[model samples]
Target: MITKEALERVRGWFAGRLPEDWRAAPADITVDREEITVRLTIPDVDLPADTAEAEADEARAGRAKAFREETREQRMKIAQEAQHRYERKVSWGVSVGGREELWTHVSAPVMTRLRQPQRLVLDTLVEAGVARSRSEALAWCVRLVGQHEDEWLGELREAMGHVADVRRKGPAA
Candidate 1:
C-alpha cells in the first residue's frame, strides 16, 4: 500500500500534468508496494473500427483513416508520458474508455480459490441485496474495507513487507 503522503503527491502531480480534456475522464488510482497505478476512464469518443465501413466512400474512408491514425499516435504519447512520470516499477493502466459495464455489479475478475464457507458468505451478500452476484459481493466487500479501514490496511501491508524481508533471510540468522 502506498503511504497517504505519496498518494497525495501523485494526485497533485497528475492534476497538474494531465491535459484538461484527459482530466475530464475519471481515474482509479491505486498504490501497491511496488508501483502506483492509474486506471483512467477514457472519454467516450467515436473510435474507429478496424474494419472499414461499407458505406464509406473513398474520400470519407481516407479521412477516417487519417483521423484514427492521429488519435492512436496521440494516445501512445500520453501513455509514454504516464509511464515515464508515475510508475517506479511497473506501468500504469491507460485506455480509451469502453468499460461502462465495470461501473455496474460486473467488475474485473480476480482468480482465487476461496474456501466453501467464504463462498457462502459472499452468496449471502447477494441474498441480502448487498450485491448483485458473488463477484459483485466480493468487490463490495473489498470496497467496504478500503473505505472504512484504509489505515489498518496500510499497516497490514507494511507488516507483510517485513514478513517478506524476514523470509528472504532464511533460518539461523
Candidate 2:
C-alpha cells in the first residue's frame, strides 16, 4: 500500500509540474519492491476527442493489454527527476489496461454442484486418506488432471482464444 502522503505528493507533482496535460493525465500510486511507483495513466489519445456524443453508458476499452510498450517521454523524465529529488525510487508508466491479473494464493469457500458419482469419488478419497474432506479431494483430483494434461489444457485454452477472436469479429452475414 502506498502511503497517503506519497499519493498526495504524486498528485501534487502532476498538478504543479506536468505540462499541458494535467487534468487529463490520470495517475495511480503503488508501493512495490520498496519503491514508490508513480504511474501516470495516459488515456487513449488515439480516440477521437471530437466524437459527437459522450459515448454514454459505455467505456472506451482498448485491447486487454499489459505493460505498455510506449509512453510519453516527458512523463518518464519528470518521474525520474522526482525519484532523484525525493531520494526515493519513483517510476512512471503509461499502460492501456495496466497490470496483468497475477494470481495470489487463496483459501476461500467455493460452491459447486457435483454429480452423485463425483461426490462419492470425493468421499472415497477421504476414506482412503488421500484428502481431508470432499472439497480437498476434489481440488486434489483437479491438480492431478492439470499436472498430467498440461499440454492438452494449453491447447484447449488456445482454442478458447480463437473462439473469443471469432466472437469479437461478430457473426457472419
| CA lDDT scores, all candidates in order | 0.59, 0.58
TM-scores, all candidates, are: 0.42, 0.39
Model 1 C-alpha lDDT versus the unseen true structure: 0.59
Candidate 2: list runs displaced more than 4 Å. Answer: 1-104, 171-173
The number of the candidate with the highest lDDT is: 1
RMSD of each: 11.4, 20.0
Backbone clash count for every predicted candidate, in the order shown: 0, 0
> How displaced is residue 153 in candidate 1, in Å?
0.9
Error of 2 at 63 (Å): 37
Over the stretch 1-173, how does candidate 1's per-residue lDDT look in tens digits?
Answer: 45555667776766666556543465666665555555555444454665354433443444434434554555456546655776553333434333221111112357878999999999999999999999889888889999899999878977876776666678866
